[model samples]
Target: MTFANVGTLGTKPGKRDEVVAILTRRNPQLESAGCLLYEVGTNDDEPDTVFVAELWTSAEAHQASLSLDTVREAIAEAMPLLSGQMGGDRFTVAGSPLRG
Candidate 1:
């Protein structure tokens, strides 16, 4: 099944722009590493909060990408900007029993 991940990033005040820039700059490399869909945006009312949605072909693919040097570097770069915590969840796509 396809895998999906939704993450919420809580950043320090005035750090949203920097956080977004970091993620945006890494988008191409992430996409090339089997990230089918990737999105990053700020919460309307919570200016310091950023939300990211990602989709990959499979859970294994996602995990493999995480181990890539580029991804590891990006995570290290982003860690300091976070204020509260980063929350994320993984899910598997669902399909009708009869369809399969």
Candidate 2:
């Protein structure tokens, strides 16, 4: 089944753009690792928050990408800009019978 992750980042004031830039720079590695869809954007109601939506071919592929040194480094760098704990959830896609 396809895997999807939705993450919320609570960035410090004035650091949203910088955080997004850093994330954007690191996105290529994820895309190369079977990320079918990757999107990052700020919350409309909360400008200081950033949201990431990612879809991967499988959970294993997503886990492998997380194990990369570059990914770890990027996450470490982003930690300081955060105002609160970063959290996310993973989901498995279920196809609709009507769409098949």
Each model's lDDT comes to: 0.85, 0.86
lDDT tens digits by residue: candidate 1, 1-100 = 7789999999998898888988878456677778888899987798988899988988888999988887788789988998977798889978547557
Whole-structure CA lDDT of model 2: 0.86
Candidate 1 lDDT trough over 10 residues, lowest sum: 91-100
TM-score: which candidate is best?
Answer: 1
